[model samples]
Target: MRVLIVGGSGYLGQFLLKYLLERPEDEVIAVGYTYADENAGPIDHPLTKIDRCRAFRVDAATGEGMDACVRAMAPLDLVVNCAAMSSPGKCEKEAELAMNLNVPTHLCRTLLEHNQKSEAIAPLLVHLSTDQVYDGESPNSVEDVNAPSPVNTYGRSKLNAELHIAENYVAGRHVSLRSSIITGSQPPLRPVSRPLFHDFIVNSLKGDEAVTFFEDEYRCPIAAVDIVAHIVALSKLAGKDAKTDWLMRYNMGGPDRLSRVDMARQTAEVLGVSDANVEAVSSASVDRGVISPADISMLSNKLNSLTLVSPMGWKDQMRLALGMAKM
Candidate 1:
């Protein structure tokens, strides 16, 4: 199988690439604006080589180098979009730029056309969306029943992207995965990418003074490895025989429903530190430019009923995440 991962340099992208590389039969293409430039060649890993694994620089926001990249990696079996301008503050400050990256119509259109040209069945397009699409007033239900009312520009843009792909692409060939805040080790190549909420908590544990985390803000903090696992599992089901309804959407969130402060306190516990070192603060005390939803935790009834598979417990996942980060 030939697989392509857009935004291959980002945090989730890198982790996905690493996890997928375990499959020797699948030739993976990692595309990013900076990955190619940074490595100056193919990415180096034990399971990956220059031949079967390759990298390309492409700008998904403007479609620059998209066609060329796609042509070179033509007949792709799957395309996973992990690209996004995920920062709420940044999205609020630069709405157009955020929209371009988050809801990239041109990029999706180009992929749709590419899939149409393929001799085999259409390539499965798996897009990663955020749980933030919900207003965060309560835990979000399955995609079918819940109406997305995003409170921030980041969520709005991600929701728009999800809708755009659903409306434009072939039904069974596209799937949107709505997930909570991803927590894991940072990719060594692109350390400059935006820091995740989990990172802040982990860093705070190492700090000398107490660090404040929002007590009211809640999310289902999923581990990066588990997210990649779900994506890979879903990608394997992409075909004419795959379930049509399942292809539409899914929610990949950890089972634990936790607030920011709770997550931090847990991290401290795992690190053998006192909870007093980590302070709990309300979101109201923060001066963030963006209006965040109070809670965007999610669970998928479809997956539970269909496969009986759910994300691993956040505590165990958190331990693995912290272990990987220390590596």
Candidate 2:
């Protein structure tokens, strides 16, 4: 199988590239914009040493190098779009950038056009959406059926991207995976202004200043490994079965639902630091401009019912991530 992963230089994308290369049979092509720039942060991994894995510099946002890249990798088996300006704060600040990257209009158009020219079956497109799409009112939102009422620009843009694919693309050839806050071992190596859960925790632990976490924010944080496993399994299922059910949108939420403070305390426990190092604050304290949903813990039994990848506990995933961060 031949796979093309856009945004391969990102936090989640790096893990996806590593795991996919483990298959040995699959020829994976990872495309990222930062690869060509010298000043950009490092996206290199040990997996690049393998003969089957290759990384190319392609700007999918502008469709600069997509046509040539798509033409070269003509009959792709799977295409995963991990590219996005995912930070809610950043999206709020730069709505144009968010809409341009998140919408994925050009990328989808290129893939669909290429697939049309090929004799082989259209490649299964696996897109990553967010749990933030929900209004945050519903505790356990169902996939596809629940009407998404995103509050912020980031969520709205992501929701729009999902809607575009769901409405325009052919069924069975594509799927939009709505994921919750992804907790993973890969702590941000560079100085990230908008830190993720794991990055924020690890950075706080490594710093002298205490970090304040929102006690009201709740999410079903899944491990990066688990999410990547689901992506691979879903892709394989798409190839193995011709059923149109695989085309449907599904949420990759973990079984455990936790708050921001809970994650920080867990990280402190893992790091052998005092839980007091992390301070708890209310969502009302921040003037983020974006209205975050109180709870985006989605019920993913329907997704788990279809695939063998059962949702794992957040505590276990956090512990493993802490261990990896220390290494």
Give the per-residue Cα lDDT of candidate 2 at 273. 75
Model 1, 64-151: lDDT tens per residue? 7778777777777778888788788999999999999888586677777777777557778888998888987766566776788999
lDDT of 2 at 136: 88
| Candidate 2 TM-score, C-alpha based | 0.86
What ranges in model 1 sit over 4 Å off?
25-51, 188-192, 240-243, 304-308, 324-327
For each candidate, C-alpha RMSD in Å? 3.5, 3.6
Residue ranges of candidate 2 with Cα displaced over 4 Å = 25-50, 187-196, 202-210, 240-243, 324-327
Candidates' C-alpha lDDT:
0.73, 0.75
Q: Rate residue 43 of model 2 by lDDT.
A: 42
Maximum-lDDT candidate: 2
Q: How well is each residue in 215-234 modelled by candidate 2, as lDDT tens digits?
A: 98788888878888888888
The backbone clash count of each candidate, in order, is 1, 0
